[model samples]
Target: MLIPKLLWPLLEYEISTSSVESIEAIINTFTRKWLGFPPCQRDVAMYCRKAKLRLPLISIVEEYKCRKARLMTMLEDSDETAVRLFQSHLTINRKWKVCKAVEQEKKALK
Candidate 1:
């Protein structure tokens, strides 16, 4: 999940100058050396699967905006400390959601 996000830009930038064979060679070499296995079609499939697992960044940002708006509405009628605690909880829950998404992506790759 995380590796694809970082590597995608580099891959896109390289694709223009590299032949498909050379690109596969590069990926195969890396996987053989780092992962201790020769690259297979399954590795490519896994990348595709992981890519599909991503939520659109705009959607995530919009969700946070909505949550903040809701929090602000609640704050207007609620205790400051209580609202702060709820906000903190919401943030933690968001983090957990991200972790779960990544975990699911990993599972899909398998």
Candidate 2:
């Protein structure tokens, strides 16, 4: 969880901008602050995968989900807090991918 002292203002901004992009920018900053120091590329991938899951309305949820699933499978040892936070922050209900009816129909045909 983000510390309240550091998070309240960001939340306030979220309330004002009313844009997922604004919230994502805040999250990217947070991710960089938390995970961008002296870690392996795999670590960055893990964090990014988890972030994509927790973040609402990511345009590429399917991709992130695949990556996260693979990472989760590879990790017998995992951080519970990170997983919980990812699960808790899931914003899927508030967002959806827009698809043309034709596109959806094509997928169904496949």
Candidate 3:
């Protein structure tokens, strides 16, 4: 019930990867409780296993990327000749993009 609501925004709007991660956490916590999965075990283990089993479980992160790209392409190739890229605002103190998050993760790995 809660999961559907949480997932809808990923397709509807642009959100940071961390936000998506928090959504993932909330979902995993609920799923873990429902499934009686262990406290120590990772939440990703379940999804990962489902993916390995070929049940076609795609994480929200992947969905976000695909949807974002599709939307961008649609805008780029749209009938409107004056379609332009959205300019982000200056008021936001922090803008967390997926690329930046990935770079940070890579740095942490190193």
Candidate 4:
């Protein structure tokens, strides 16, 4: 989400410095702030509640999943065309991973 995008630069900086503690601290801080629970105490029910409260009524998460599914189906149906058009720009796998992570995070809130 926007939070992660905003923190990406800081994350990269932390990675560059090879500071595991700092990276963990940053992740823990954000996890607590955004998820309403510490990482160690996360649970699926709490996550769902937090997500329902935090996400707008429209739910960007649902939209994202729908779009991703459509794109993947398109790619599968037109593998050659997709390859030709995307070449090095295709990130379906990475996007899927991000989606999965987001889902997992949402299922891991307080």
Model 2 ranges off by over 4 Å: 1-18, 38-97, 101-109
Off by over 4 Å in 1: 1-58, 79-110
- Report lDDT per candidate: 0.42, 0.40, 0.58, 0.44
Q: Which scores better on lDDT, 2 or 4? A: 4
What is the Cα-based TM-score of model 4? 0.28
User: 1-110 in candidate 4: lDDT tens per residue?
Assistant: 65445344532231222243345456546656785765575433333645655533222233344444444445545749745464223343432443354446558874
TM-score of 3: 0.59
Instruction: Extract clashing residue pairs from model 4.
Output: none
What TM-score, computed on C-alpha atoms, does each candidate reach? 0.22, 0.27, 0.59, 0.28
lDDT of 1: 0.42
Each prediction's RMSD to truth: 15.4, 14.4, 6.5, 10.4
Candidate 2 has which clashing residue pairs, if any?
none
Query: What is candidate 2's local distance difference test score?
Result: 0.40
* Per-residue accuracy of model 1 over 16-108 as CA lDDT, tens digit each: 222433545564566546755444544443234357553222222333334444544465457677664553333334223433444465589
Candidate 3: list runs displaced more than 4 Å: 1-5, 49-57, 87-110
On the 0 to 100 scale, the lDDT of residue 98 in model 4 is 32
lDDT of 4 at 68: 42
lDDT of 3 by residue, 1-110 (tens): 55456567765665666777777777678777887878897756765743554323456666665555555555556676665343122112144443344446558989
Model 2 vs truth, CA RMSD = 14.4
Model 3: ten consecutive residues of lowest lDDT: 84-93
Worst 10 residues of 2 by lDDT: 93-102
The top-ranked prediction according to lDDT is 3
